[model samples]
Target: MIQVRGIHKSFGEQHVLRGIDVDFHEGQCNLIIGLSGSGKTVLLKSVLGLHSVDQGTISFDGRVLGDMGKKEVKVLRQEMGMVFQGSALFNSLTIAENVRLPLDFFGDMTEAEKDERVRFCLERVRIDPESFSKTPAELSGGMQKRVAIARAIVLNPKYLFCDEPNSGLDPETAIVIDQLIHEITHEFGMTTVINTHDMNSVLEIGDHVILMEKGVKAWEGTMEEVMDSDDSAVVEYVFRSNLFKKLRAALKKA
Candidate 1:
């Protein structure tokens, strides 16, 4: 489990995260959902250690992140896998090479060992070995995202971070990716954190939802609770629902 307590961050004089507190559970999709500039991205970066917090504490299973030495931090990072918004694959490298990149950097495995691990990770994500020789330009967007997932899990990370996993895919494709991530995450029992603005993802996969507004944690609940909550801002945010809009219109006409 990941525990975050009183995490405060600032960019010079502009405070972005205001004493944020939340816990991300393992084997579930912990989602951070909020409007743009609500400090969701800042929170994600702070948790990942990409951006340091001015105050508060973040810990992985009770090990405080703020006090970790450089070597300890490096070890902690090795257990982490991140899927970026853009997929972040190299256009020049083949699919196999891209998946093998992390292992190359951190794993002391031989060339043959790396190749075997690369192929295994790709197959696990349902990417065929034939695509191993193909570059990013040769595959579709969905395929590219799967390749990114393969690379991420190739490290067998204990924690996974996804930033806007469904940003560019079509709705149908987005659902597919969402289910895929949810399944693999639970199977490995990995601690996963996803930053999303997609309500569909929120309703479908979110075991824990953290809603932020103006740098504050406005709400936190499970998917079912989120769907049925009485919070005005949450209701207004999800008021874009077709059924709700239709009900309002019919009531007004009556």
Candidate 2:
């Protein structure tokens, strides 16, 4: 599990995160949802160690990130995986090659072992062997995202972080990706953190949801609790969609 305690961060004169405290449990899809400038990105980056917090501690399991040595930090990073918003696969590399890149860089495996691991990851993400040699440009958006996911899990990481994972996909494709992430999180028992504003994803797979407003954690709960919540911030943020408003009304009637 990942724990954030009273973490604060600022950039120049702009304060991004303010005393944000939350726990992201293992084997669950913990979602950080908010508007464009709601500090969601900053909080995610802070947890990923891309940005330093001004106060408080971010811990993986029980080890505080602020106290880890460089070597220790490196080891921790090796156990973490990230999927970017753009499905950041290289256009020049084939699907298999992209998935193998992490293994190539950090793995001590022999050539045969590397090949087996790469094949296993690709297959785990449901990518066919036929497309393994194709470049990212040749595949559809959904396929590219799957390839990205394959790369993220190639190392069998303990922590998985996704930034706007469903971005740019059609609704149906988005749902498929959401379900894929959900399944992988439980299957691998990884602590998965996803930063997204997609309401559908929030309702569909948000095992733990943290709603951010301004720079603070406005609310935290499961999806079912979100449906019943009367917190103004939760209501204002969630009911922005007419569909959800109607759903809430139906739930109330029922």
Model 1 alpha-carbon miss at residue 138, Å: 2.3
Q: Across residues 1-254, which tens digit of lDDT does each residue of candidate 1 receive?
A: 99999999999888999999899998988999989999999999999999999999999988899999999999999999988888999998999999998999999899999989999889888898889999989998888988999998998998999999889999998998889889989999999999999988987899899999889899899987776677976776655688765654575577
Q: What is the C-alpha local distance difference test score of each model?
A: 0.90, 0.95
Give the per-residue lDDT digits (tens) of candidate 2, residues 23-82.
999999999999999999999999999999999999999989999999999999989999
TM-score of 1: 0.93
The C-alpha stretches of model 1 lying farther than 4 A from their native spots are: 243-254
Worst lDDT window (10 residues) for model 2?
118-127
Worst 10 residues of 1 by lDDT: 243-252
lDDT of 1: 0.90
Q: What is the C-alpha RMSD of each candidate to the true structure, in Å?
A: 3.1, 1.0
Clashing pairs in 2: none
Candidate 1 all-Cα RMSD:
3.1
TM-score, every prediction: 0.93, 0.97
